[model samples]
Target: METLPLQDYNIYVGDFDQRLSDWLAEKVYSRLLIIVDQNTKMHCWPLLEPVVSAYQHSLIEIPAGEDHKHLETCQQIWQTMMEARADRRSLTIDLGGGVIGDMGGFCASTFKRGMDFVQMPTTLLSQVDASIGGKLGIDFMQVKNSIGVFRNPQAVYIDPRFLRTLSARELRSGFAEIIKHSLIADREQWEELRQISDLGKVDWPKLIVPSLRIKQRIVEIDPFERGLRKALNFGHTIGHAVEGHALETDAPLLHGEAIAVGMIAETYLSHRQLDLSAEALETITDFIRRIYEPVALDPATFPELLRLMSNDKKNESQAINFSLLPAAGSVEVNRTASPAEIVESLEYYNEIVAVGNRI
Candidate 1:
């Protein structure tokens, strides 16, 4: 097990071979609650039962879906913990993807003025991005992860075994973040990832080295998100707004899918607004389209999406903040954007992708 210590924070990440029960035996804890979504409860918990035998383990299964990322769902989870008699000494084992790690972390962070939690992140997205970061929160009023706090976990056990069970779409969704990570930090990793073809063919152990290195380096520079940490929000500006809008209604896009488009479109903004190269923009857009089908935004939906962006959490004042990629490893924040300019950028992105699809 290669352990990486997250300093001054409880977050411990590792490709751990030792069982969670054995790890927990060293620490004094009152009880254990293993939280899982409906799908994870059915597919994942059986493997854990054998490993977490030393503790008094209980399962708290919640219905899966973006609609459930609300205060009501969180309240129910808290209620269950209360019944389970979870106190400060108790721990939460978040055993699933981003939604599980994110929402579960929020519950543990607030439970009894904060209880410790471990992230047994299943999905590739959660393991590489969401789970590793101490950002824990739930959606509010149908926004994408709007209500949350930055609280580190006690441990993050990343087992690549879960990738075998992921559907192709889910696999593609996670790869998008890997692409984002590469774009933000390591240009070499970017080129290497671009060379990757079949997502199923990847050497799992090799991929984590670059991915975690980028996140750890970024977080270390600015743990409180005062400066450099904001760079991680590269594709998230419009991506999150689109996610928030779609999640509210009939169809919702995955985080990576929206971000794929977000990164492509944001590339245009980066070039025009931040002087990023045109070649790099094309490289990112082309690669993302290989994994994600760009959604055609109707004339009606585009405006509503913009409205969501206006309310983005990063916006300090009334200006919508953007993380523009001027170079491979560099980004700038607090970009002042006009409504007309933002709309034009989205329209231009659609034209490029639509032309490509038709060809």
Candidate 2:
């Protein structure tokens, strides 16, 4: 029911296959390209294909992973779009996770100097979070969202039905963003998620409104991300670094898993330096452990991870800034801590492990 601020753009968020197809037939431009990852091409495209068939739907598939969100990958996608002769009248319907949504939006925003993009986010992560916001970009030098632009989509189509095809890990991954959203703005929304008997068995109708309202309100206030918007990066500071590192290696964790760790570690920072209550941090840590595989970050991988974080684009000069949680539903930004503080934060994170609850 929530609509994007931009005119001529409606974010259709329920079961409306016939209406979606009918609307696409009426509103979308002439050339239609459905950008998707291989996984979505296999799992979700089947359901969406028929709806947009009339607009000369061109299926552009990229490799399904974070490693592919680079200039090289964009080059390939650009070539494919050109091969299809996508013009200004064309619309790119991004049909995948954040990688697809971000890259596809960027591709459309740049190619031909600007084309309309409609997000068709498949994963719970993208639907509830990434797909809506106008922040579009690809990774640069393996940094998370390092190369990109802030171009809103023509529309964002989030169908909960798509979540049925996602792997359990993928669902959990997106839920991290959901948790981040709730933490930054709405405690009641956080409680709704916490009380859910099954995170996977989400009540789509009951859930979509609060999440959309929160994100839309924030974006409306700070579309350019000059100040208030940076708060959205709460779990992302360390989460992004972890994501970049994992991508450098073979065992890359999906973004959400890395963020689950990021949230815990950043919460540690908040607990020690900021005014966040320890009880709330424990509740968050417990929730995360229930959903994700506990990553026991040993001392050996500590320095490299820390270095990767320093190299992150979010840093100002030599100091790395973070959107640390002072409390749930409240974030404090640019609270740059020293490297020693970061190490201590990691140690503090390890201490929070359930082995013997030091606190």
Candidate 3:
């Protein structure tokens, strides 16, 4: 029954069955649509089916992976809702990870001028970061989140049971966000997290709350991402570029994985631009490099990645901007970086990997 109440909605965190059933029973809706990816259809839906079994509900499934997060996928959702005669009173239960939560929420937010939606995040990444925020949209034209809107859900349901089904790689991917949260907002949380040598055996229940709180506090101050919330994009500018390139090459990186790499590169930028100390940079980079494999950024791919970053929504007047750390738990937002500084940072990332290779 743990909860984080927002302006008009509440995020219920804990056991899902009773909370979901109790919440649904109280709402008056025309129909219920549970949107999921293929992975969740096989693993997560069964756990949730019994709770919503009595209600009028239908399932909309999409192919799994970040590569499928695009306009065509959203069209299918709109078509399904239209054929089903879903109205403003209809509720969408986004029952998977970040992709499902984001794409489903985007669809619900836009369909028939909007409908009520709920988030039942079934991945560590979603549970801790993506699901709580109102940001909803899909990648467009090879750019990450290029066509999204900010729209809060009716409610968000988070239960850690879903983490049990995730693979080791998925778990590690999600941990990158947890690490990012700590680095940007909570020094003590960063201290607690850095001690862990094994991700699989880490205490998730304890780890998740602090990360969720960091994001919630920021979102509360700037739900529309005008200023304070931009700090939450700490690694996303470069991360999104790396992600877009990965997707274009047909070797899509998970959102968190790409961000992990982005954080390392941006940490270098932070040192050069924000004057973050070398010691702090090393500590941060070492931890992240241990968790994620370096994306092979051919010097040739730098232009494409740079092009992707230039298109980031955070930028203005064609200047490349970043949300960078001056130190752990401290961020400076909307700071501009020159192309030379960016290429240097990428080279620094490559140097780190090359050094690791020699070891």
lDDT of 2 by residue, 1-359 (tens): 44444443577777658667776767758688888887898888889877776667688989987788888888988999999999998888888988899998999999989988888888888887775568888888666787788888867777878888878888788878888888888887888777754776777646765777787777777787776777887877778877888777768888899888888888888888888888987887777766777766667777888788887777778888888877888888788878788788777667666443432
Worst 10 residues of 1 by lDDT: 8-17
| C-alpha RMSD of candidate 3 | 1.1
Task: Write the candidate numbers in order of decreasing lDDT.
Answer: 3, 1, 2
| Model 1 clashing residue pairs (backbone) | none
Where model 2 places Cα greater than 4 Å from the true spot, the runs are: 1-8, 354-359
Candidate lDDT (C-alpha), each: 0.80, 0.79, 0.88
Top of the candidates by lDDT: 3
Candidate 1, residues 133-164: lDDT per residue as tens digits? 68888988666778999988877887777777
- The lDDT of model 2 is 0.79
lDDT, model 1: 0.80
Worst 10 residues of 3 by lDDT: 289-298
Where is the poorest 10-residue window by lDDT in model 2?
A: 1-10
